[model samples]
Target: MPAQPSPAQSAQTQLERGNGPEPSTLDAHRCQEVACGNVLRDLYEGLVTEDAQGRLVPGMAQRWTVSADGRTWRFVLRPGLRWSNGEALDAGQIVASFRRAFAPATAAPFGELFDALDQAQAVQAGRVAPERLGVSAPDPRTVEFRLNRSASLPALLTLPIAFPVYLPAVRRHGAQHTRPGQLVSNGAYTLAAWTPQANLQLRRNPRFHDAAAVAIERVRFHVTEDAAAELQRFAAGDLHITEVVPPQPLVSLRRRFGAQLRLSPYLGAFWLGLNTTRAPFRDAPCAAGATRCDDRALALRRALAMAVDRDKLTRYVTGLGETPAYGTVPPGIAGYTPAQAAWSDLPQAQREAHARALYRYAGYSARNPLTLELRYNTSTPHRRLALAVAAMWRQTLGVQVRLRNEEWKVFVQNRKQRAITQAFRGGWIGDLADARNFLAAFGNDGPLNWTGYDDAGYRERLARADAAATDAARNAWLRAAEQRLLNDHAAIPLYFYTSKHLVSERVRGFQPNALDRHASRWLSLSP
Candidate 1:
């Protein structure tokens, strides 16, 4: 008889993260992509998690208790939890991870998530030590968080950055701990191999907390930025799930693979981010100068923002269903009322005329026009959208706008630099369901606020909202704050995204949610 394959050698589930070929970071503390979140969720457990229906469910802490004032929270860890290396994963690790997330040295991009925790802001600002932050381990199995104020926190705990960091692995390997072979994880899968710019292999972790319930034995992430290429892989039977359905063949594929094609609205927005600290975008461009950023710079931004036709972009360029974005916060997030963005209600001709006038007022004309570059990450849909917007700018404002593209990981790193490229594409698939979740990243010194948008009035409004006594009051203040940001033209709202994925027929238990988060741990493949 022919030699039989070992039991370990079996069929695997394959998936893709973003729309293109980009190798995102693996460290939960540093990772930011939604796809990265998907994998990290499988690899690490948070205090709480969202079910496929978007409801919060118990995770590392099987159950929790909150103080009446909401400033103190106590999480009781599930017993016998162990890391992939078989070390006890306890409250101490959870406490350490929370501290590391806000520690200035760790440089976690989502550090702003700790804005509510006591003394974390000071620690994040380098004014205090990370050890001074409020989280502590009251016992071997209990982690407590003391907050600055009483507000919603459960949703915040579900963020990827909140995942416990296994300190022993980090200390041993330093920055390279998350590398394939040296990793120690506590999730459904462990890193098997990572080939830069090609693919990443993940083997099911036999030591996972819920290992018995994890159906998929193996998983592979085919790193790619090309939407068309992803479609090709799906057709070739290489990818079991593709991140984006190519715009060109979306309709045909829906008909050809009816059961495999999934389309649903996601809680996200695609917009244009202007780096307000740079030349042309900033009037003074001096950090310590007495002269404030000129209003004319904002005028230029408003001119460009008004020129975008979101309705056309959603209908023509985005073949998959998407809604025109009037504001940063999408329509259905609980406790938030959408604020009217600039030019949302203006007539087409009037808006065009106003944009041209603003451009002229900002010292630009056809003879001596202001030129700028537009940057975006790789993806066919992104390319088409950039081109469409470029054409609109040329037609409406007569300004010279060039289009540029970069891979996802490199692009994210670029966006974080203080001296970012003049203008770039930015979007957010929310880490939590709240208006602040969308707005917090734009704070004066927020890690994601590369734009250098600092306004005392806006800051006050945010503070008021965060401290609001009730959800209703909180939302009112948030709405006002959002309106102020739009008036300043902090970012150009384009369109809200709709997720379209290619799920193979063999897979099951993939339920769509507004967050568009689907962890591979919950999935099973037919024999």
Candidate 2:
């Protein structure tokens, strides 16, 4: 638990944060967006949580132990635990939450996080009942997990998918259980009020186990998707922290705010996901009497990937100290080295020439341009990036590019369905500091596998990685799997992400970490 706040810290307890679009739902099980996860972090506590430095710490579980084989873990809950509604919270409830998250009816988007658990895959596929999951509550305060193989389970527990839910409220309200008045949270804060497109308010949870250490009594998350508008709000003193800093006015912002401007390496990747199940990208027969019998779809995808100049995109468009990425997983992950594209080392002129040749081989030329749509969510940065990429495609490969922007909810839905999507903007932020968190998403049956990427060899390598007995063995298999994905051109890795925010000088305890998670409970405002 954090130390108790001083008298001065308690005086100005109200905090206003400029945030992105309104979360589609507060239900942790169904959430897939980073913005939604931010709110969920405050409303629920899993078996483990992260501190200001993003280090894993005890949450609901005060202490835990792992077996010699490393396939079984037991956690002992904190004493006198109670929900925000004043109901007793025990190990049984935690077990129930795990079952609910894996249940087929729930359709949890991030359910892949639990794939290491014994029988978790079978339970999610409806081959077995949810009760057959590896989690069991042996006693009122003791919960145990049985895994089929060894994994970083403690770090995985810090994710929202492992957080417990109030079963009684869920039963009574169904999907509406997360509403302000009905939500029964177990974290440092509770939902007080929510106005769509405006703000979502939370108050300190009096029944929280560490309430004495919570500094902020009230927190208001103001929905402002546009970075320019968020910056205005922050400058007007209506916001203590801006969700993102617009790339256009970054120079001015740095000059004005100086030390208040926060920029840190974020463990995420921004990329273009080609719908491998749809036209223009799906595996198709090569042209008749072609010199090479390679898959034309693969050639087209690779051509598009090679045409983009990622260095220019990062230095000019984003301009926020982001690293140009040639692979799915970002750098700096412990025990792993990321894989790069085969053509990553080619000179720009030579790369463009090679892309043109591949484009022609794919049966598209200046006379017959390959027309396609690029879809992205509405955001200033997204629009600029999309436009730049479209221009690059048109210039390098004689492709007709169409840009389509949709709201957050609609864009996510269309991208997930993949019936009409051609090439869409996609990204993933690591739930833990493991390369598996990024590589596993491309698995054939992965919930986050939006690209329809399915390869028998790739899946086999991932399976071997998961069952490996040592870190070296696991990372070797993981690296081989990533290399296969990059060679196949499943997705175009644009650049690694860097979190850019403008935090007021008055906000204390706002530490920058690789995960970019800053909960209001650990923050206080100076008057």
Each candidate's TM vs. the true structure?
A: 0.94, 0.96
Instruction: Report the lDDT tens digits of candidate 1 across residue range 1-527.
Output: 98854643455344433334554767888877765776677777788887767778988888899999989999898999998988888888788888888888887878777788889889888899988999999898998989998857788888878888887778899989988888888888899988777777888899887899988877877776788888888888777788888775466776888888899878898888888878677754445755665578888988888888888888788868888887888877886789976578898778889999999989899998878888888878889999999999999988788888987877877887847588788878887778888888776676688677887788888999988999999999989888998888878889988878888887787899888878878788875
Model 2 CA lDDT for position 58: 95
lDDT of candidate 2 over 117-208, digit per residue (tens): 99888888899999999999999999999999888799989888888989899999999999999999899999999998899999999999
Deviation of model 1 at 268, angstroms: 0.3
Measured over all alpha carbons after superposition, the RMSD of each candidate to the real structure, in angstroms, is 2.8, 3.5
Q: Quote the lDDT for 166 in model 1.
A: 83
Report every candidate's CA lDDT: 0.81, 0.90
State the displacement of the C-alpha of residue 208, model 1, in Å, after optimal TM-score superposition.
1.3
Q: What pairs collide in candidate 1?
A: 20-224, 20-225, 20-226, 21-224, 21-225, 43-187
lDDT of 1: 0.81
